[model samples]
Target: MTYVDGFVLPVPEGKIDAYRQMAESAGKIWMEHGALQYKECVLEDAKPEMPEDAPETCKITPFGKLAGTKDGETVIFAFIVYKSREHRDEVNKKVMADPRMQEACDENNMPFDPSRMAYGGFKALVDL
Candidate 1:
């Protein structure tokens, strides 16, 4: 089964470019280390249009809310795909060991608050 590392983080609105640049670098590294796919997307429409007749109870949490974005912040949703859990671990190990990744982790150079980021590893349930 395919495995995925998914993460959502809030980036300050003014720092979007910095975040993009960082994500681009990380994506390249992940792909070079055998990630099947790497994607980083910013939130566009938080209030998505729903069926006119849909119940209010069916409303889903918006990305901004899910990511706990603040007034000056927005959300970034990213994922890296691999062949399996074992493959993901292998790729991540290589990625983390890379000098570029090490530098990004040092000195809290990230464009967003690391403590507020949400992350998880998921096993494929449905692939179509």
Candidate 2:
């Protein structure tokens, strides 16, 4: 079983390289702090394909729509996995305390708007 932290956010298309650099740096820090895995993925083909039998309210919304992504922006989905909730807490505590993490969060250096980022912790229901 694994506990994970997930994130979804919008980033301008022109800023994708900058965002990738930031995510790469942050991912390394998370791994160094004992996270089992760290991944960041940008949306490629996000068209929604709803089942005919599904309710109207159940229509699938693409990541871009869900994030209110602008014409020149795209969505990024990211996650960090840990052995368990306790392990996730321990690793995150260290990651947050690291100087590199602080450097990454410096207002002048951040590649994206922190306020627009959606983040949450999840318990893995099925991992195969």
Candidate 3:
């Protein structure tokens, strides 16, 4: 079965560009390390929900509107998929040890609030 690591976090208004760039780089590393896919999306049309397993989807939104979302929130969601849990763990370990991981983890420049991030690992039961 495929394994995936999913994440959601609030990205600060000021550092979106830097965070995107960093995420892009990290995504590349994950792919190179054997991730089947890596995806990131910005929350655009979200309404208050009883936070479920994950947001339904993300749509495009004006930068200003995204920045001004209730409580000044902008969600960044991502997922990395791998062939299996063991492969996911192996690649993740390498990703963590890579020097670029430190740069990617630079919270000062990261748009997302690390402390409030929601994340989990999932095993895919079906994919179509």
Candidate 4:
């Protein structure tokens, strides 16, 4: 089964383009490093819900909910799929150590709060 990783973060209101550019660049890198797929989507809709990992709900809403609204808070979401957990680990190590990833450390260029970003890894239960 494939492994998956997800991320959610609040990007600054006016910096969507910058965030997109960065995400695109990094997404390509991730794919080159063995990710089966990489996707980044904007939060078009949202709802107040409590999830186990984030009990308070924060600002992220499920994709189903996000599909209906407009002008709501834009949360940047991304996912990377890997062939397996071991493959994910191997690719991740190289991705993390890549020069481009290190160059992404410029605090001034970031459009979101690094400390507040939510991220996690999951084992794929189903793909269909």
Best by TM-score: 1
Question: Each model's number of backbone clashes?
Answer: 0, 0, 0, 1
lDDT of 3 by residue, 34-107 (tens): 89999988776565444466566743455334334446567787899998999999999999988888777877
**What Cα-based lDDT does every candidate model obtain?**
0.91, 0.92, 0.78, 0.78
Give lDDT for model 1: 0.91
Clashing residue pairs in candidate 2 are none
Candidate order, TM-score descending: 1, 2, 4, 3
Q: Could you give candidate 2's per-residue lDDT for residues 1-128 as a string of tens digits?
A: 89999999998899999999999999999999999999999999879687789888986769998888888989999999999999999999999999999999998887778788999999999988
Off by over 4 Å in 1: none
Error of 3 at 90 (Å): 0.6
TM-score of each: 0.95, 0.91, 0.77, 0.77
Per-residue C-alpha lDDT of model 4 across residues 9-109, encoded as one tens digit per residue: 76665778888898988898898888999998876645556656775646564753342223433677789989988999999999999999878867777
Can you give the lDDT of residue 98 in candidate 1?
Answer: 97
> Between 2 and 4, whose lDDT is larger?
2
In model 2, where do residues sit more than 4 Å from their true spots? Answer: 50-58
Model 3 earns a TM-score of 0.77
